[model samples]
Target: MIGDKPAPPVKKTRARRPKVKTGCKTCKLRGVKCDEAKPICRRCISTGRTCDGYGIWGGGGNAYGSVSRITNSSRSPSSLPLTTITTTTITTSTCTPGPLTSTRTLPPLLGATTQHEHRAFEYFFHRTSRKLPGIFDSPFWSTLVFQASACDPAVLHALIALGAVDLGKATRELACAAERVRGYERVALVQYNKAIVSLGVHFRRGGGDARRVALITCMLFICIELLRERFKTAKTHLGNGLKLLGEMRRGEGGRKRGGELVVNTELESVDDYLVEAFTRFNIHSSLFGQDNILLYTIAPHPSCADHAIPRAFTTFRIARLYLDTLINAIYNLAHQVASLSPASPIPKHYTNTQSHLRSSLDQWLKAFQTSLPTLTTHHPLIAPLVTPLLHTYYTMSTITLSTSLSPRDELIYDSHTAAFESMISLMRGVFETILSAHAPLGDEIPDPPGFTADMGFIPPLFFVVLKCRDRVVRREALELLDGAPHREGLWDGIMAGGVGRRVVEIEEGGSWGDEKGQGEVVVPG
Candidate 1:
């Protein structure tokens, strides 16, 4: 037994070391060793794996990723690469309530062309979603809207159409050539038609959530038309959306026999996300003199004396929302007061409201300044994304308030010349940041003259040139406006500058020659 069976001691086996957790996230996730690169790892790029990025807290995306899931598989090829719209050029769609939802796998559409539809979806995810939220962070564009898009063909097509318009930014030049048609415009029109048909089909079906789908589609329609620069069509879409919302509200308000709300919860006005979007569109539009009914009443922000305002804004978005509320209140108050006769004294209530709004603005500025140092720390892209824009908005809001009662008086703006000068500085810094941060993904991906669905720098810049009589400041504003062609909602920098330059010429009794920017801004045919 000892002779043959003194089994050579079983070969000793070395213990297995914990799997090496090195390299980029995608590589680490694949259980392969990583090269451990900064920002993005080369290993992932080499293998065509999205870097999924690198961070100390976790992998790519924010701390609060979206809970919503897009269960259907995408009809498009999975191999197509996603490009990032630079931090400065693209903004918002967040950590989901998520901008650009975490649900990467899109639900399939029954009749979508694999390549065409997929590219549109990708553009919206990477570009349009971010631009839609404007200065404030909104989950409507990033999360709920995507969810709705995934579920509804109408919404999907509408977004695809929008993506097409946004993608055509650079195509404007080609489009304006009399011999050629706008390539992207053709695509957008096709997709838009499809969306209308699809939405019609939904309406005919009349499902329990038909109204919900309608509201979502209507929002998409507004966005689609707005970005396409068809203000009349967008206005029509908004009117329809508002009408649908009004119907829902009236039904809720005029309920039946019992005290309980007889209206279907799904049909009882649009959900918070939908209503918020619609309300924002209405408010922004009406502030510029559009005849719109305010869907939801804005509760007046408590006066600073009434003990409102946080010690310091916890997030830039929160601060933005507070400022926007005040801006809307100021605009709304100004709107109501503008109707009064020039000889008449401002009403006591209106004066009180103005006083409160002014106080709130002061308090907001104080809080914003306190949090300025830490603002960039809120999100990785926060600095390029919102910092300059917020500063620009604050300056404009201050100007807006001081001239509230004097909307017709060009003379009043002279007092705000310093503020206008500051705006030019802010804009110069912004344009520099935009140029530095914006990296278009080669020639195939057209970077249209900077276009955003949100109201951005254009409105403020146009306002500066229109009201400020200081020729030097006005010219500076015009030059800056003309320098970069961007569309921030209805305010197209090129058109605004061209028209503003003409007005200046007439008012100054002089001619301005050769004032267009690097790219010829051809008006959309």
Candidate 2:
């Protein structure tokens, strides 16, 4: 084994031919490519968009890919995913997807419409919202479920930003959510059913959109009534009936429309109504206290201590109570703020009450602002979760006004006023944000009346008495007022609204349903 000098040139084996680098713009843009002998080629992608070679990019889409750029020159970003171009360079940590661009503009209300038309309108609107980029726009459960169904990193982060969900008020949000979803008719009942089931779980768990339930319930009812007027026919009637039935059932275990579940729960049952009303009554009553709770507070009085929340109030009743409190609280607070008498010494009770309530209000508002994604993503269903925040804000506003006047220290009062101003700004933002999101559907939903001094929840006849204002609002107000039993000062702070001549016209020789200067009724202006 003599190694001859330079062992006869051991030939180096030629390196395997380098695999042809098939240039793929799309793959390169996505930072990945196809697994083929050709590696990546033109047939693999057209117009610089990833073809996935096959439709592998089918059911589950590109999970964590960059924003999808439109290849078609004719189709503008406005028509597709990218709506507004970021001409102003935004230097940030990284670019993130935004809410989807909506294609369909708000439809003009056609006086009224048929059931089929209504469904079509809604579908079209939904499709428009779909085009908007973001997890909320996706059909898969949560935006975070992409590739893997783990909680969205974005969502989890958002939750932290928003603060923890209010465990104390979770049940209330869930109950109201169930009611909000019990409407819409389906082309395929099964699809609706499935939607409700999935939706119900979120709603029941108080996972999202629990606050806007009452407002939506009212909006939907108004929509349906208007639809009835547009198309008067047996089929239309049947469609309307089925839709209402679906709403009552809440899309659980129902027929399929276009392969989606259709929920057809009935909203008209005595039991359903009672449940809805009880939810509001209990919450409001607990906040206001024992003797004041009305209709469905659920607590047993001495005579009916054994009984639970009554099961007879309709969805209408529950909706009414929430709406009444919301409007009244806001108007009252606003008046209180505007009517700051410069001369009076600030009351201690008012200051303390404001401080306590303000903290709670701030906590609630901050939480809701953070939860917008979950609520917006789960619209028409989860949207109600935001409703309670509305009430909370109004309540806080009331406290802010009271506190502003309470602090005896001049410097403290100025500070309180500044804080109160900030709060008012936030409330206005909440209101505008909510209104802007849902293109003004039909007429602007009217502001519900505050409680009248009589304890009867009546819309003041002022709108009716005055000639120039909206008749529909006037009529609705009057109808609500018919239910009130006048109680003194009961509505003093609630209904002295700035709309017109004091809404409560004093009944000569009588107090509002109370003996003049006696009974619970407050004297009318």
Candidate 3:
């Protein structure tokens, strides 16, 4: 039976190919041809390796596995491989002109950073003029020659205008030309001097420009530095500078301007520009100081104008007149406060020392009243000086008030109070008159220098008067009605009301009131 079992029919076994799927992960990663299959692709199994399912498929780990699997896909199906693709085509812009236009060369001397070296290569302006008599010939031609030849007024004006900034550099030569000694050469020299001096006139009318002003200012101080005789000439230039600044301010409205003079745009009224210019001038003029040696010595006195050549007197002289007026006003205020001699005795008609103080006040007022018209006309800048002057008065008053007599004496207190009030009243009246006289008429320009000084001078004066009775006499001056400190309140009030600029225009016939004139106090003389 076992031998018969051996005769069982022999069985046949056949090899089956692996089935393919839609896409292979290895093919996707390597971007090569692959047969898509299920569990294991035919290509993977054919390599005699264990079939790891498509490595790039979602079921796999990160790209590392896929990248490793991609090696199997690199076997080429054809001799011409995909790597043979080359020779790219490119299009360029047509607008570029040429290499010369594109390339720029830097000189060996040129700086790699800030452009310092090319300074020598920069263009220069060389000036030439006729050699005038008695002075070394100027390398720069005078601007005046154009005007004298009756050349284009605009061109001459432009030259004169531009000349201001450079005036300092050329002032010595200008002064030399001005002082030319030969009588025969006088005509040309005179014309040249006129041209130089004309810069000032143009400056007054908003012509001599910024560069000229700077030069003139420099020359002014330089004259102080070098030639004593030239100081007057320098002063003249400076005065013209100041005057021109003032004119621009008045013309530009009330605003002040600075830097290179600019055209008045419609949006920014000329008057406003003028105001701004004037303000800058005020600040600048202050630097000259009340007593700069250059200004004081070189500045012409008012009487200097009487000379045959009135033009020779510098505008500084005019400015000095203003200064003199200020000094006089200060002196008078100080004298008024200090020279408060007691009355002889109580009169039957008058009550006490208060009455005598009033009489003295009236006398002061009368004198000031008589001079009011002339003061406003000549010293129109007085208003702006008031604050400093008032502050000065207050200081003087404090000293006088402190040293005068026993605080316990009612008569002493009364007399002091009366005197202070009367002085204050007189000052107020003076201010009122000033306002009336100088108020700008329709389309009329205020005298800019005077207006500047007046506008600037009032606020401090106002404060000096505000709490006088309390601050000096009353012990509780520090405490105000508000729980806040008195000083704080005063400052707050001033700030809320434009600080220094409030009360610019006093009401007509009312010292400190609105146009309707209510709440106005008639200051008792």
Which number leads on TM-score? Answer: 1
In model 1, which residue pairs have backbone atoms overlapping below 3 Å? 23-34, 93-99, 94-99, 100-142, 169-448, 170-448
Cα lDDT, model 1, residue 132 = 69
Q: Where is model 1 more than 4 Å wrong at Cα?
A: 1-106, 111-114, 134-136, 165-191, 201-209, 246-270, 286-289, 295-307, 511-525
Best by lDDT: 1
Clashes of each: 6, 66, 36
Instruction: Provide TM-scores for the models.
Output: 0.69, 0.23, 0.21
* Candidate 1 C-alpha lDDT tens digits along 361-449: 78878998899888766554546647777788788888887788775787887888899889888887877776776666455445656
Order of candidates by lDDT, top first? 1, 2, 3
Cα lDDT tens digits for candidate 2, 1-525: 576576577788965543434333344334544343121134333343433221211111232222122111111222233322121111112222332232222122122333433333333222212321111112111111121111122221111111111111111234444322232222223232332344344446441122112212222222232222221231232233334433433433333333212211232212233233223322322222122112221121222212122232223223233333333333333334435675865456545544544453444344445545554453433244234334333443444344444333333333343333433344344344434544422221222221111111112222122221333343333333333322111122222232222332331222222321222333221
| TM-score, cand. 2 vs. native | 0.23
> Please, what are the lDDT tens digits per residue for candidate 3 over residues 217-241?
3322322222222334444545554
Q: Least lDDT summed over 10 consecutive residues: which range in candidate 2?
A: 160-169
lDDT, candidates in the order shown:
0.61, 0.29, 0.28
Error of 2 at 190 (Å): 4.6
lDDT of 2: 0.29
Error of 1 at 287 (Å): 5.3
